[model samples]
Target: MARFLLRRLVTSVVVLFGLGVVTFLMTQVLPGDPARAAAGRNATAEQVAAAASRLGLDRPLWDQFAAYFGRLFQGDLGTSVVTRRPVLDDIAQALPSSVELVLAAMLINVAIAVPLGVYAAHRRGRFADVAARVIVLLGAAVPVFWLGLVLQLVFADRLGMLPLTGQLGFGREVPEITGMTSVDALLSGDLPAFGDAVSHLVLPALTLAAAFIAVVARTVRSSMITVLDSDYVTLARATGASERRVVIRHGLRNALVPVSTIIGMQLGWMLGSTVLVESVFGRTGIGAYAVTAVLQNDLYAVIGTVLVIGVVFVLVNIVVDLVQLWLNPRLRQPARGAAPAPAASLAPGAAAEAGPAVKEGAVS
Candidate 1:
């Protein structure tokens, strides 16, 4: 486990490094120059040049990379050209909103999808199963922006049941003790603020979660079906286990590893890829922050945001791996313990390290 975790950490570092490089180069190759963007349109040539020089854009690309990399190591994400604030600070402020949004969406998705999936699998090939399939198809087929718009139009604009925009009511302010609006509101014991926060969150969170729930439900349903048909499940059934116990304790428990893995892998996607949802809902989050950075041609902000997203992706995967190992102890063991490596299979250096071959039960 230690070795596996160490290996994963090293691989994550390499992946994140590559992500930073690719993101930096992509942002660099974008049409508008950040320095010029920082300088107003009315600025003279010398003023633009001065801004470029100040931002170190006048330096060689490699030099700029080195400086940026050094700053990254020191927890500096550089200053946002448009906002005139540290990119790090902006990210810090925005990250909580994204976190709150993603977590709420995932919770909603799992709460709906998991039980529905299990029930669909339990009644495989029945009306329930077909209905589940249709739901998944519709959910996956719907575009995020269109779904968000339609939701707002129906629930907010037409029905007037929910707020159209923002994370809270106009006048119902909650302390930012935690960055999450609902959480902070709840913590502050402001029932009205909390109620307003939930009202504002409903459409956006549900819209964001819809596709994810579909995908997860399908995956879970398939895995559960296979688990139900397995020999152990048959044995459990023969042993006079109740149908519910057989399904929940035996089938669902064995099937959940895959579902957990999928959910974990989607965490970053939920958190970082909700740009359209955030826009439609008029919520201030990392997604909105990144969108602004891109529109303003703020290369530093773009790179920083991308780096954070990449890091989150890596971290989520690590958590998934750990969960998988915890749920399936067999995953930690050698796949084929009956076979041992032959001397000829060893590389020259490994061969040198090997003293001699031994009998199956004998110590060398």
Candidate 2:
């Protein structure tokens, strides 16, 4: 386990380095003068030149790259071209909202997918299974923005069942603890504020979850079907184990090994999907932050956002690897060091000497 963790740590560092390099190159190719963006449209050439110097943009590419990484090592993500504040500060402020949103979407996805998939598998080939699959297909096929608009139209504008946009009502307040409105509200014993936050969250979370729920459910359904047909499941059934017990205890548990991997892989998907969802819902999350940064040609902010997402993706996959090791005992076995020497290739003298011992041990 220690070795496994170390390997993952090394791989994560490499992944982050590659992400940084690629993001830097991509930003360089973007069509706009970041110095001008930072200095403002009406600024004189002198002001733009000063801004470029201050931002290290006037340095050689290699020098600037080195400087970026140097500041990165010290936890500074440089200044945002648009905000004129530290990019790290902007990310810190927005990241928690995105985290909360993604987590909520993931929770909704797992809660619905697991049970629905299990039931669908149990009723495979029946009308229930067909209906479940159809629903999943529709969920996956729907565009996130269109779905968000439809949800907002029906649930917010028409029915007035939920808030139209934002994390909370205009004047509603919750103590800023975690930056997650609901969590912060609960921490402050503000149940009404918590309720309001959740009401605002429902539509966006649902829209974000719709894209992934089908993927997860389909994975679970397929895995559950395979597990159900395995020898152990058949043996359990033959032993008169209840269908629920056989399915839940024997099938679903094992099926979750693959499902966990899929769920972890979806972390990136969830984060990416938040871009569209946040825009439609008017949430000020990292996704929205990213969109704003791109529009304003904020080089530092874009780089910072990509690095953060890549780091998160790596961390989540590591956790998933650990979870898989826990769920599947076979994965916990120590890796084999080397192949044993073939008996046929052994020295004749050693083989003769070992043959009697082997025969005696077998007889005993």
Per-residue CA lDDT of model 2 for 1-364, tens digit only, reads 8988899899988988888788778657878887888888999999999989987889999998898778878988768877889998999999899989999999999999999999999999999999999998899999999999999999999999998899998898987899898999999999999999999999999999999999999999999999888755665565566888788887888889999999999987798778899999999899999999988778778888888888888889999999999988767676677765444332222344345554565588
Clash count of each predicted structure: 0, 0
Write down the lDDT of every candidate, Cα atoms only. Answer: 0.84, 0.86
Candidate 1 matches the true fold with a TM-score of 0.89
What TM-score does structure 2 among the candidates reach?
Answer: 0.89
Q: Report the C-alpha displacement of residue 26, candidate 2, in angstroms.
A: 2.2
Q: List candidate 1 stretches off by more than 4 Å.
A: 334-336, 339-364
Give a tens-digit lDDT track for model 1, residues 198-251. Answer: 888888999999889888999999999998887556655655658887788778
Q: What is the lDDT of residue 254 in candidate 1?
A: 78
Give me the overall lDDT of model 1.
0.84
**Per-candidate TM vs. native?**
0.89, 0.89
State which candidate has the highest lDDT: 2
